[model samples]
Target: MTSARRTVHGTTIGIIVLDTAFERLPGDIAHAETWPFPVQFRVVRGVRPADVIEGDASLALAAFHEAIDDLVSLGARAITTSCGFLAAVQDELTRYSPVPFFASALLQIPLIERSLPAGRRVGLVVSDANALQERHFRNVGAEPGLPIAELPADGPIRANMRDNAQQVDRAAQERDALETVERLLAAHPDVGAIVLECANLPPYSDAIARRFGLPVYDIVTLVTWLHNALVPPRYRV
Candidate 1:
């Protein structure tokens, strides 16, 4: 609710969050500073990270819808979530939301794929490679066969998410993220662009892009696009 943000981006964006206890570093969607525009967050009650990744978020459909209602009531023009695994429920939640609902950064896959050169395709860096299912891509309108990678489970990035730790080891995170991107690129030479499916991965987006020399897209970009559509800047003609 900063006046500075209001002057630049008029409306508020709502973020549906999972119930967890992790330090959200700058650039993480849950971190308020990650957004240039103002945002409102609603934690879907009792919905944990496991529920999102393991359950595919289908079990919490009604809860997510309820959160959307609350946010819409609070003047939120668009809605998004803190977890990329929410892509599993993207189709249904989008249909149920009163306003625009961007459930996951994975939403960028289809567009990125189509935007890439003929021989290149979009590659994904996800939080849990094992948890990703075909339905996640299908629900977001992304075609199957796109390559994917995961943060090392033992690394600070994945460890913090798993333990919901408040302290972050940033250097370690960057290293792990960079290595993950290297693996993704090495495995898929035709990858023209990189899409981070996990909302937390934006913190390392710049590093990934710099190291891999590929355009990286995440929730931040997706939300910025929505923010622009909802409240375009005024230009003095």
Candidate 2:
């Protein structure tokens, strides 16, 4: 009788992607070239970006499970999502996934908090403040009322992204991101580090880091760190 074991290969990271038609640039986590190591991408069909961000996660949970199963079948050792808002579903997804699962970049908040001095908080830059909830923080071990700044939903950046416009106004998006960061700092001057809560924000990370001279954490940083653990480099004599 032939053995029924699953055949696994080289890919180490499995990215759970949203069902969106937007253009993903090089820095975007969903972009293949974004990572140095090989990765497998599984798009959770029917789970729109807003569905994860603005709606309850019960409906999207099944989509995540199905995607994770496909990625594992393709030999992914670890899993992560393309949206920080998915942190709301982190517990459920992690429970369903057999491999190590990091559902959102917001999972880095608690660790980043420890690095800051007393009374200094991590400032968050997210796609929408009104949509971010206590459950999103609780699932990721983050405290409720974490200082946050939301990108204007009515602005060109959100409009372009939400509509999946063919041409993204990079300059406009950058301006809005920067303005939000500035506002956050103005409100919370004790913010020691800034975290970009939206996966789409890493494209502007360097600019934000340069303008503020603070450590900026995003999905790229979180996933790269997770990838290192999932596939540590082999030492050759």
Candidate 3:
């Protein structure tokens, strides 16, 4: 076993990502790139939702394990996946590796839910509502019947947002996000916080928080929490 002292700051982090063709999506990968820490990442190419769920679940686990092992070989202390939808395999992935692993940003839901007051609720803003399940919410410790908003899944809008990167039309994304939040808040007026389920939504977090006048959580914030927890500066050698 690697001694605790040997594993301290010598640890790196690996991020397993899908092989999407889009180049401008500035999600967690971007955050990891600029993270002010000594971490490394390895992308496990060619893994997609359809292949993982329909082709073979074990294949997905195999790919995830392969990436984790590669990172571990390079001295990674922990692992994190790029997409929230991967939370389904959180348990299985962790079982195959000894290092600390975070399945998705939504993993912060349990903490967010606990911090809210009674009658108030936590809401999720995701790119695709159809892909989300009650299990995803439950895995994160959210109460059943929690409100959620799906951004316009239209191809053109998504394509435009992805292509622009940080230059993405703030007004457009905020309009869509705000419309969804407004609709949810109208129905569930007690919701006190909003969680951005899509990692790409962080660039617009401040606007969403300012417009809704509520706390907003996104992958950037969630990853920051994970970074602090698993790789604290004090832990660095």
The best candidate in terms of lDDT: 2
lDDT (Cα, tens digit) per residue for candidate 1, span 121-143: 88888888999988988999888
Encode model 2's per-residue lDDT on 167-210: one tens digit a residue: 77788888988999999999999999999988988988999999
Which RMSD values do the candidates have, in order?
4.1, 2.0, 4.3
Lowest summed-lDDT stretch of 10 residues in model 3?
Answer: 21-30
lDDT of 1: 0.87
Candidate 3 residue-wise lDDT, 129-176, digit = tens: 776776666666656567877777564335554453334455676577
Which candidate leads in TM-score?
Answer: 2
lDDT of 2 at 136: 89
Query: In angstroms, what RMSD does candidate 3 have relative to the true structure?
Result: 4.3
lDDT of 2 at 74: 84
What C-alpha lDDT, on a 0 to 100 scale, does residue 101 get in candidate 3?
85
